[model samples]
Target: MASSSYFEDSSNELTCAICLQLFEEPVTLCCGHSFCSSCLENYWESREESTACLCPNCREVFPQKPKLQKNVILARLVEQMKLREGEGSHSVGGQAEGKDGEGDVTVNRMVNVGGHESHCEVCNEEAAMRCVPYETVCCERHMKPPKHKGHNLVEPEMKVEDPGCTEHGNSIHFYCKDDESLVSLLCKAEHQDHEVVPVEVAVAEFKGILAAKYPPLVESIKQVGSQIQQVHQEVRDTQVSGREKEERLEGERREMYRAVDEKVNHMKRWLSERQSVKLSHLEHQRANLQQEMDSLCEEESTLKASLKELEAVSFLEGYKDLLCRLESRSHFSTTEPAPPRLLDFPVEEQNVDSLIQINDNLLKEIQNGRTPSLDPNSAHRRIKISRDLRMATRTETDNPYPDHPDRFDRYPQVLSSESFSSGRHYWEVDVRSRGRWLIGICLNSMGRKGRGKECMLGGNPESWCLQKCENKYYTVHNNRGTLLSVPGDPERFGFLLDCEEGELTCLEDSRVLHVFRGNFMDPVKPAIGVYGDDGDSVRFCHLFMISFIPFCS
Candidate 1:
């Protein structure tokens, strides 16, 4: 009670000229008259002149707009009145008849002025109190109406005053619900199209709205976070598995290297043995030639000795005999001995010789091991499913696969048997020999029968897809199409669905082409399409939707 009654402003200083009530956002004019920011603007608009602007109180003429500063000191007091009213203070005015008259409302509400002092406006003496209703600062001498006294004076609530709205010189009383903005009388007039309400009412209404949705929003955030954690775990597992694979691959490589080295050594040894055999045969031939040369030399010597001893006739006879003997002896053909056939090097034919490097492709982003296949039951009658279910082709005549609700009737399409509700899933389609095809994911909730919007791929919100039409490629959803300017039709296309992130990505030839993000409210199944010129088939290289965690190798 003591603190509440410290001082009070009973003067009409708090009153606004336009509203004839408490000054809301009070502002002082250059002529020294004060008014509510809103009230002043209202007053000035009524006083606009063709030649010059005039003040309503002083009749002071000016030419342009004025400036305004907010009255922080008075704003605090208004807040205190609110606090006091909330505390259920005794009411001076009955039944909340006034804005701040709800409880313990006194004609003079005490305000802490932070020890600031002011001189009386009338006598220029140290003021004992301020008269809020009358808008005056007064000393004790001017407490009563005498030659220098005033009746409206009251105890000081605050030592200083607060400024009002700059343009209208009024308080911001109304809130524009349409724009969620605060407004004064002047502002409210300009915003006649807006749904304006009192600030208090708007506050309660907006708070209620936010409070209603808070729980669901928080829950959604938590759910998304949990999904992210799962993805993180998958990533960690992939790293560990990759490292293990790396170790295994290294071991394989070493073994292969050793085997190659052994092959090279064996080949070298075989080559050496072949060369030795060839040389041995050549050496025997060489020995026979040498022995024949020695015999010929001895025969020649005998013939020469006989020619010296006998005459021409005897020499001729001896020569003939020598020739006959040479002829009769084992004769050597005038040809070189043929070497044995040489062995050919077997490098390419060797085992563990050819190298193939398995590197990361864009499809590898999705770490999944689940290999899905076309659910034969869901295939169209004209769609021919391979025995392995990995390949599907369109034929002129229907194979008459057993009818199922999930089967597509008119379109040559098939969906994977397994549907993914959450987690990451990746699949690759070999479209190298295919000219026209559509690849994407569709909500399982989508209709399976009829050739209407319900069952149309990339024709409704229920589906997300990338398609090929004629020579052009496109991304489509809900009958809308975005043209894809690509170099050529991709050989192998990859699709990645991150249910947690609510994204569907398209990879063309192991390169990311596009990504779609939004609310994936239902489990999505892989949708394969064959249309346009369909000669080739679609092969599912890897329909990996194995589980929450999947890896290709």
Candidate 2:
């Protein structure tokens, strides 16, 4: 039998006596014994009974079946023991059960007589008792437990060794591809050239590239500036060309305007000349008409005088017939021969015959007027008498011998002659108490004389003359000391010749002349004249004529 102390010690083991380990499934037996429940049930099952009871250590038995009773105190004691063992393992080199013994050895030991014993089979010696409370253990060669199979383990070496390049079969000492500098590793060797770099050298090379390219860019910009200037010059040239064309066109326009102005002025001058010529022609026609009108007026005056004389002759004849009738009536009635009947008288018949004879002789004289053979002596006498009568009539009509007005000391007079016979004649006439007049003459009656009629005449018969006078006795002789016929009644030739301070005289004919005073080119006094016929030896026997005298200032 085991002693009470032995039983108490066994109880304190805190392990299952049936399994000889800690109580995983604790149970109570019928004999008031405690054991692992699984161990007790297994023993009951092997016996093939509904109920069983037994003492594990004492072998006591019970007739009734056993009920399970939790062993609270024993479970508390196991939990406490696990805690103490975990603490002890952590402090003592992390061992849960203990350290292993080296070498294969066996040991045997008897705890007591008739007691449970343990022995090592290898060394055959008493085994040291152990309780493996935890699940695993590991050694330094495998740093992880066998349960954690995936972890890789490395052994600690004394020094870190450089890895060898796979391509070179030597320690890697070349540049790293990532940083471009020396590195060592088999894994990093493939990317060495790309990663390894020298920081200072790379920075310097980049700056040099930028500097070398600068001048070319500046030169390119300068070339572009030159091109822009050339474009501006081209534009200026075009502008200048446009201005020159405009100036040329303006000059042409001005020249065209001047040409038009000159043409217009020439036309104006031509028109003015044409108008002047027309005016001159009109004036000439007017002057010729005026001269014809004056001639007609003189003829009208002569016709009127002839009609008045005829009327007077008719009245005188009527008076004579009336006187004869009265005388016959008073002496008649006693047959005293009827007092010589006037109706039968020869006086009336004789008068009629005489009138007829006069008419016939006038007609005959007019027809044979130029014949030289019929009664030459009487013709000569008749011519002399007619000349004398004409002289007297002219002198009377002109009033040459009239009573002088109270204003005149000696009356001034002008005499013009148509004819004077051949001789040199000189005479002096008193014009005023203070002045004397002289008359000189040269006679050339016939053309046979040394003085030809042509020589004596100075100009056209409408133009020539001589003078002898002061203001009065101013005379012009057309036939002075020459045999020149008198012109017709309405036409005469002569001039009143006078001496002025300065004058010009132009003789136009034997009896016609013009006198001008002052400059010959610009005459201040202008006069023309005509002459009447009278015999030689007659003093102042010319007919007086009046003409217009221009007033001089």
**What RMSD does each model have against the real structure?**
21.8, 61.9
Q: For candidate 2, lDDT tens digit of each residue in 1-553?
A: 3222222222335655444457765665654456777876665554434465545444455666567777886776666556555554322111123222543221122222122233222232443332122111122332332221112222221122435555656544334434544433443445634643222223333445676788898898899988889989989989997787677557645654554465456545755665666667666766766776675566556445545655777656665654565465456443212122223423433364455464355334334322111111111111121233221111212322323221111212122232222211111111112222222221222121123333222221222333322222333334442222323321222223222233333222222334433222221111111122222211221221111111110
- Quantify all predictions' global Cα lDDT against the true fold: 0.66, 0.36
Residue 449 in candidate 2, Cα distance off native in Å: 99
TM-score, one value per model: 0.33, 0.19
Candidate 2 achieves a global lDDT of 0.36
167-237 per-residue lDDT for model 1 (tens digits): 78786656776777678877878788876655544565566678899999999999999999999999999
Off by over 4 Å in 1: 1-368, 543-553
